[model samples]
Target: MKVQKFIASNMIEAMKKIRQELGENAVILNSKQISTARMFGLLKKKQIEVIAAVEPQPKMKDVRVKEKRKPLSRTEKKPNVRNQSLTSSVYPADEKELNNQIEELKDMVQKLSEHSSPDEYKYYPIPVQTFLDHLRKQGINGMIMGEINAKLLNDWRSENREKTEQEVYQSGFQHLKELLAGVEYGGSQFQKKFINLVGPTGVGKTTTLAKMAAQAVLEKRKKIAFITTDTYRIAAIEQLKTYSSILNVPVEVVYKREDFQKAIKKFTDYDLVFIDTAGRNYRELQYIEELKKVIDFSQDIETFLTLSLTMKEGDLADIIQSFDDIKVDQFIFTKLDETATYGSMINLIFRNRIGVAYVTDGQDVPDDIQKASAETIVKRLLKGLGV
Candidate 1:
C-alpha cells in the first residue's frame, strides 16, 4: 500500500490532489480540520488534512510458447519495424488489447476485495453476516456495528452448534435492545402538566405537538390546552389555532416570559398544557438562550427535542449538542418516511444517554405519529432487510 498525506485550505482541493496523485481508486483513510498559527500565534487559518492510500498493482506473469518451425535466416525477410520498443514489436496488437483488459479486470477485483469486510469477519457464521449486512445497510454507525459483531461472535463461540438462525436473530435483536435499555420510551405520557416541544426550523415541531395534544384529548380523555412561543411566524400560530379549533381546545399565543407564565396560569384547570416553541435556526447559541428566556426549565415540564431523520447524522449531532444547555428530556424524531435509515435514532439515544418519546412519519396531524420503543426502533432498523 502506498499512503500519502495532503493538506489544503479546504476538503475539495485536498481530494483533488489525492485523485491526481493516487488515481480515482485511492481510498481516504481519515480527514480532519486543523488550524495553522501565523505571526507569533496572533492569527490562525483553518485547513483540511487528509490521509489516502492505494494498493500496489500486481506483476504480470510471463508465459513462453515455443514454435516448431525452423528459425529464419538474417538475409531472408526482415519484419517491418519503426520506432516502437522491442517488447511492443514482439506482441501483436490483439495481445496488447487483451493485456489492457486483464489489467482493468484485476484492478476492479482488487478494489472489490479491499471494500469487503476484513479476513477476521469471514470466520463468523452466515447468520451473523446477514445481520451485520442488514445493520450496515440501515446506516448503523461503525462503533455500534463493532459492538454488535463482538456480541454475536461471543454468542457463537459459547454455543456455536446449538443456536439456530432464529435464535441468533433473537440474540442479536436483544443485544440492540439492551443497548437502548433504561431510557424512556412511548409517546408523550403527559406526565408533566406542561409539555414543551423544541427543535430546529422545519422539523415539524408544531405538527408533532398538535398530534400529541390530539392524542391527549381523544384517547387519554384529558383536557388539553395549547401555548405557543412561536410568535415569530404568524402561520405557525394560526396553524396551532386551527388545530385548537378542530379539537375544541383553547390556544394561547405567548411572546415574552410573562406571557408564557400567564398562559400556564390560564390553563391551570386543563389536564395537559402543550407549549410550541419557535422553530427557527436554533443551531446557534443565541436561539437556545432565547428559548431559555421564554420557557421556564425549572418548572415541572417535559421538554422533547424534535429532530428530523432526513438531516445528516453530523448535523443532527450538532443540533443535539447545541441544546445541551436547555437540558432536553427526550427526543422526538420526525420525517421517518422521508429517510430509510433509522440508525440516527439509536445513535442519539446511546451516545447522548437520552430517551426517545415519539416518531412522526408524515405531515398528517395526529395520524402518522407512533410511540417510540426499543422494539419499534429495532424493527424499523431491520425492517424488510432481514436478519
Candidate 2:
C-alpha cells in the first residue's frame, strides 16, 4: 500500500492538495495539526494528514510457469474453498470497521472545514446590543463608539436577523463597546503586589494562579508565592499545592483572620504573591462579610474580582455590584472556552476600568493566559470562537 502526507494552512487547502497528488481513491489513514514556524512570535500552526491505500491486491503466482505448465484446469488453479474452510467472517467485520472509520473521518473533515469558517456561517449570533457594549471597553469613548454602533441594532434586527454574519459581527462589536464605556479598572499598581483573585463558584481561581505564577517565574523570573483562603472546597488546597510544587513556589493556607497576617509575612520576601479565595455567592452579604474580613485582614494586598464570560451579561453586573463593597483593583476573566462568543468582557473592563490582569481560556494552566491589553481584547473579541 502506498502512503503519503500533506500539510496546508487549513483543511480545505490540505484536501485540495491531497486530491491533486494522491487521486480520489486515496484513503486517509490519519490526520492532525502541527505547528508551523512562528511568525513574529505568534503561534501559527496548520493541518496535515497521512493517507494510505485502502485495499491491497492479491499477489500473482508465477504467471509464466502457470501458463506453460497448463492449461491448468480452473479447478486446480482456484483454491478448494470447501476443503480450505475459507475465512469469511473477517470480511464482514472488515466492512463494518471501514464504515465506522469513514463516519469518523467525515466528522474530522467537518471540523477542519469549520476552523477557517468565514462570516457567512452563524446562527442566532450574539445580540447587537451586547456587541456594541463590548466594544467601548474600559473607558473607550462614547461618540466614536456611538458612530461605530450607529443603527447597528435596528440594522441587525431588520436586515440580517437570520443569516447576517458580517453585519451581525459589526453590530455586535458596537453593542459591546457601549457596555465597556461605564466601567473602570481601579488600578492597584501603586498598592502592594499581593493580589487576591475573587470570583463565583468554579470560576477557576486556583488554575489562574498557576498561570500567573508561571508567568512571574518564567517571564519575570521573580520570587513568587501563593496563599489560599479557600479551605472550604474539597481538594482546593491540594490544587494550589500542585501549582506550588510545579513552580517550586511556597503557599500558605489561611483559614482565619488572624492567620492571614502571619501567612502574608511568610511570603513577604517574594516579589509577587497570588491569593486564591473561596468562591462565594456575592449576593449573600454574610458570605461577603466573611470574605471582606479576610480582605480586611489581608488589607495590604491588592484584589481582582474575576468574572467568567460564560455568564450572561446580566449576571456579570450582579456579580460586580455584589462585590462592589470590596476593594477590587482589576478583573480576571475565566472559562473563556465554554462560551461560543465572549463580547461581554469589553463592557466588563469598561464598567470596571480595573485593568484586566489575565484571561483563562481553558484548564491548561500557563498555556491559556496572557497579560491583557485593549488591542488583545478587541482582537479576541473579533475572533469570538474561543477564550
Local error of candidate 2 at residue 118 (angstroms) = 23
Candidate 2 residue 347 C-alpha distance from true site, Å: 3.1
Model 2 lDDT, residue 46, Cα: 41
Candidate 1 lDDT, tens digit per residue, 10-98? 54467679879998777666666678999999998767688877755533333224313347898787555676575564455676686
lDDT of each: 0.81, 0.64
Q: Give the TM-score of candidate 2.
A: 0.54
**Tens-digit lDDT string for candidate 2 (1-387):** 456777764444555576677667555666554667577868655434545343333233432234332256766676455775323322344655765776676566555444332221111134443344444332334544545444453454354236445656655555554544444432234237676788888788888877777877887778888888998986999989988999898888888877787977786677887889998887667888898677553456777787888777878778888877777777888887787565567655665565676777888878987666564676677664222
lDDT, candidate 1, residue 98? Answer: 62
Clashes of each: 0, 30
Q: Pick the candidate with the highest lDDT.
A: 1
For every model shown, what is its TM-score relative to the native structure? 0.70, 0.54
Indicate which candidate wins on TM-score: 1
**RMSD (Å) per prediction:** 12.1, 18.9
